[model samples]
Target chain A: MPSPTSKPRGILPAALFAVVTAVVVVLGIWQPFEPGGGDLEIAGGGDPVRGEALFAESCAGCHGEGGVGGGGGPSLVDSPIDEETATRTVLAGRGTMPAGILGGTDAVDVGSYVVQISGAVEGAVPPVAEEPPLGPAGEVQLTGPRLWGIFVSLAQPAGATWTIWLDGGAQDALRVGEIPAGQTTFADPDLGIGTIIDQYNRVIIGEQLQDFALATDELSEARITALKALIIGEGNPPGANSLVSVAGEQFAVFSDHTRFLVEARDEANLANIRFHSEHLVNIALGAPIADVDQNGEPTNPGDGVGLLGQDGREGYLPQIDAAAGVGTIAPLAELVPAVEATVADARVCGDIASVEAAGPCVNAIEARSAKLDQLWGQVPDAARASAVLALERP
Target chain B: MSVNVFVADVSSGYADLMETVFTSAIVGKAWLATAAIVLALVQLLSAGRIYGKLGSARILSSRAAATVHRWSGRLAFLFTLPIVFHCVTILGFQTTDTRVAVHSVIGSVFYGAFAAKVLFVRDHRYPGWVLPVAGGTLAALLAVAWLSSSYWYFTEVRFGF
Candidate 1:
């Protein structure tokens, strides 16, 4: 009964099918396309939970439960580096970096998992906002033996608790206090010098004073001196100080004290390192005090003045972030001769204070350095890769 | 109630409501619920306009409409009873929030009015008194739900939700 012009029922069905097909084709052309980055099946699918356990075992000694570094390592949480970059850095050792901590399928899986969990990759060191002068900062009143322990754990809750107040001078003043987790507190009084903590455990101000310290006005000079001393002592010292001797260059014994000097390198680096170390110290033994340990109390040693007796504490020891990485501190006794030689060389040739000129001394020590390579050789590929990432150029 | 208890109740009640809405089964019985809600709305609206005219010409003259409205309302209310019970026992009792109590009160009232409508219609007498009761109860129930739901939606949904 179909009309001649309409054709038979079969034709009607075909026409309808043709129309639907045309619509689908048009839609396919008009819709936005997403090109596949490819299903890159890595050897092992990095299990976040396993990675977490591994992090606690091997990495936690430096990187915390949250991927933030303590002691020798730098923070890995919220790192800005992409997964690919992080993977590559972890695989290949860089300056002062150990090779192959995370290699093989396990390394790939762990690195991939870390990249997945760390939201935003960051530079070598987290940048600090301009802080105002807070008078004498880094002053901790450690009376009880347990006070040091409490201070060590202060920043563990996460986020930034310490803030900087500018005194309109070369040395920036930082106010150490407690802030709630996951909130940001500004330094401005009107804005409430203290606010809340953020996703990074960086509270504006509140809770216990996570250990803080002051930077010398001559920050660069201090860093250069410290680096020179460390390099000569640990990098290429002579005789009994030698941890390892390659060719003719000799390395020195590493100690907590030596690492402290290198930790206090730059203003920003110093703050982060100090904050990290304090958290570690708090976690380990409670607080950093003189009588509490060999360092002597803040009150003792002429009311805690001068370098040895300074009232403020030193190092963010507990925060072992692999990114910032830890430098093996060569003992001063073994390194004195090399340091003296470098000093003599610098005095004879370039300015001792010039950080730029100090490079040669650091390099000479590095050239003779053997402990790092030895350590790198002992660890698995994944660990070596992570160590490499730690030493990568900022 | 104490200030703490009051706040807890309000928060718990809101959470309970959300859980019910999200997890409810809308399949199979959708028609029954939809029909009841529609009839209840119409009856409530018509009653409001009439100023308490239940057995008046407007309703009595529309037998088909009245039957549909009456039957649908009763069936929906009957269906809602089990859902209410499940929600109360599962989500309501589990939380300390007082809002659960408020929800229970409103839901009970809704069922009460609905039951009265079913009874009135069953007896074949319009039961002039039952119409106002149903209408008033529906209005109160709607007010509570609308206010609470609207406030919660505005606060959470307007920005993030």
Candidate 2:
């Protein structure tokens, strides 16, 4: 046997293994150090003073000054609504209140202001029921004013029916009969727009909750569960309720169809292409196309909400004249064939294998390009120049 | 493909939790960096002791030193898993700024260097310089990653959570 002074055989490896295993096990069981309580700090800290100003401008009309009860809106001061609920309520609107017009930072600021001034009790808003808010998987019931807002904004003729062209050339005609004066389930739950609207609503809810959690320096389990539910859209049909389905669809189409079509002519003219195509689509949708003033600012704002409006104006407009003063260009329907022909020629050029075949492809591309140029050229120089100038302006 | 999807889902699932658990985004990263640096020092010192280059065989037996080095290295690697997961799944590989670009490149290389070091340690048939080179590269990459992220966070951004 070896002397006692000599290290035991295999002890080093055994000891090392034990130590590593123990560390792993301890780490697995040990709770990560959470910066809860006083240790937590909100990222990009909020200013309640600035938030107060924003709230007065955007919210006081309905909520009254100092968030006291007034004018069809409930009392916001000492309101039981938590920060999360208040933010979501402001963003999506509830009951008679319209959806908040404020963007991200402004929304957060207003929310912070409301929380500060109102002394809103935390965790006051009741938990959402376990059941999915939008109904079952394939059949999601789209109810509430937010969905109505989206429907009204995107409706084909601002009344009657909405038409959506799907990815495989299937056209869906949804009869939106009347804008619901109150919360009502949509008759057609299977429409893709309903699904998109639902997803958007959930995202808004989740984001507000996240903001609340950050502001409070506490990510409660309830908040996490709610956020996860909203994000995952657990009960929705596979791929329908996810952000990947809604926003992803928009992005993919914009990239593959719109970008591809525009880039075919001249890759360097993306800014001009974006301006023209977006406005063209806006015009097609029967929304107002704004006229630029001498300073290149949109003079006559189109009456449409969100990014769909060409004029970069916010709020609702009853009727938008597509061709007020602009000279006669071909109708949007007439322009589609030209755009398609150009795209087809570009594709053909991409597929050509022979050097000799390149001549005809070039000629075909040039002809289609000229056709589009002539078609777009019919519109008055003022309108086109205004759009170009607006695009270039900060 | 399924595996990739699964990994992505799991990574995404923990992203919010990770963000919440950390002190502040910047400070939490600094803590992780400090831990990694300390472990790296332990690894280097133990490695030196194992090679008998520290001039004190009495301090720790070669086998004991090797064991310490191995475990310290493993611990360091374990510390990086969550950071890597967050970076890959949530942040993706973005080069929007100079700082982010350098961090992204270093983070990408750190994993490869780690793999090389682990392999070299196990396989003795390689040239003697291989293990040292691999270890040194991993250390260097980790240092750069720490500097670009945590260092920048502390110096430029506030130190508090």
Best by lDDT: 2
Top-TM-score structure, candidate number: 2
* Candidate 2 residue lDDT tens string, B1-161: 01123332343245334446653233454666768978998888898887677984447888998899989888888878766644543344545577777876677656655655665676565568767877877788888988887766554432434
TM-score for all predictions? 0.23, 0.30
For residues A81-114, what per-residue lDDT tens digits would candidate 1 score against the true structure? 5554454444332322222233333334445556
Tens digits of per-residue lDDT for model 2, A45-140: 234566677666556534545565332255676654445545445443454343323423344456666676666535433222243222101112
lDDT of each: 0.33, 0.42
The iRMS of the candidates, in order, is 26.6, 17.1
True contacts kept of each: 0.00, 0.00
lDDT of 1: 0.33
Output the worst ten-in-a-row residue range by lDDT, candidate 2 chain A. Answer: A385-394
Colliding residue pairs in candidate 2? none
- Where in model 2 is the C-alpha error above 4 Å? A1-394, B1-16, B19-21, B56-58
